[model samples]
Target: MADVAAKERRILVAVDEGDESMHALSWCLSNLISENSKDALLLLYVKPPRAVYSTLDGTGYLFSSDIMAAMDRHGYDVAESVLEKAKRMCKDLHDVKVESIIEDGDPRDVICQMTQRLGVDVLVMGSRGYGLIKRAFLGSVSNHCAQNVKCPVLIVKKPKSTVANN
Candidate 1:
């Protein structure tokens, strides 16, 4: 491949703080580098929506504002931890410009929006994640992202289990 410009290609890596996601991040670092330049790596952690309920006539709703706040806080912390761990694992990335973002919304939707807004050329994400049940029924983040996002999407997965293969 020819040399690429540092700013030309933007890569967005979506992680859900799952160990499986680390493989995706590592894949991005190892594959996306240019011979004469480097590209931007954006780490995004999506915070699930907070429940909100109103009390009417002493009836309680399944909602909590504090829950939302906590989710946001946790998301930020996860983003910070992600960057720190990335640095620890891939020290060479120290010179490459990177951005850590924590956003609140549906993982698939937010990822798609970020890709469009940032003009991302490549998206690296995990095949499976923290919410296995939701993903199984609603659609996995990797599956949704592959179907919706315009850019190329890479789905990282652990080695298959022998039991499953048999």
Candidate 2:
């Protein structure tokens, strides 16, 4: 137990605006992280690349520089908000170090790259609970990372609240 606690580990938790990711972070803190251990909790938020709008396509209106700048700012703001929320969740963790990173790219690719680049011991992320058809069409980030990453991946599925029958 002492050896396990003494070993330093890096655990990456990919987050976004969705409640599922936040739920996964909370679950990771409760079940995987130890208060006394020298663990580094990394909160990663990936901003998708902005769509390229062209006047040649169909729309006569071209995207102005101001519009593009505003869009970029909005993306930055969202990343900050998500990271802040995640940091607040880790406020109680006195021993474990917490770090936040914001990267711009596709979530699936960025997440996989970060895990390997950071040499994470374990990857933690949320399951969106998409159905078979939806998952097939949209693709699953968790599923992709699980198959690609070398480290152990933990996909936390947020349980649906059950209502008691009267």
Candidate 3:
């Protein structure tokens, strides 16, 4: 059989601190991406807008210096940990290229933009599998990306058993 993936496929998987996103990454590793010479997997982690807005924006209120510093530290720590864990997961898959991308913005928008910019063959991500009410209240990143991205979107939902354990 011909090695179809050798044609240079770029698969982008959006990940975060959530277990669901990690599961999606794992799924992509084991199912979609393979040890094809020209294929690449891009793991993207988007840090949402900070809890506190800058005083430069003209807002009279300002977050305390200590609190703001803590927020910065936490964001960096989480990003590094997640990316490292993701990289470790893919280390054994020889011949499959892996890249980590960390961005700061609304994930829904960032994921869509990066997907097109990277010319991704497919955007793989996880769905929180929220009910209609929950999704309506919080919105769904995977759902939004599926609608907006130019590339195909693959949303891997958490298994029922896994969800139950959490």
Off by over 4 Å in 2: 1-3, 52-61, 129-138, 162-166
Candidate 1 error regions (>4 Å):
4-7, 34-36, 52-72, 134-138, 160-166
Q: Please provide, for model 2 over 1-166, each residue's C-alpha lDDT reduced to its tens digit, 9 standing for 90 to 100.
A: 4566686899999988777888889889888887787899999998766642222224425667887788789889988998998899899888899999999876778999999999999999987622343345447878898999999999987777823111
Q: Please give the RMSD of candidate 2 to the true structure.
A: 5.1
Per residue, candidate 3 scores C-alpha lDDT tens digits across 24-140 of 888887787666656788989887656322432345256678867787788878888988888888887777788999998767889999999999999998896223443444378
TM-score of 3: 0.82
Model 1: lDDT of residue 94 = 48
Better of 2 and 3 by TM-score: 2
TM-score of candidate 2 to 2 decimals: 0.84
Candidate 1, 40-137: lDDT as tens digits = 77887776553211222133344367754665576677767866775565556645667777787778789999999989989988898645654644
Cα RMSD of predicted structure 1: 5.8
Instruction: At residue 78, give the lDDT of candidate 3.
Output: 87
| Candidate 1 colliding pairs | none
Which has the higher TM-score value, candidate number 1 or candidate number 2? 2
lDDT of 1: 0.69
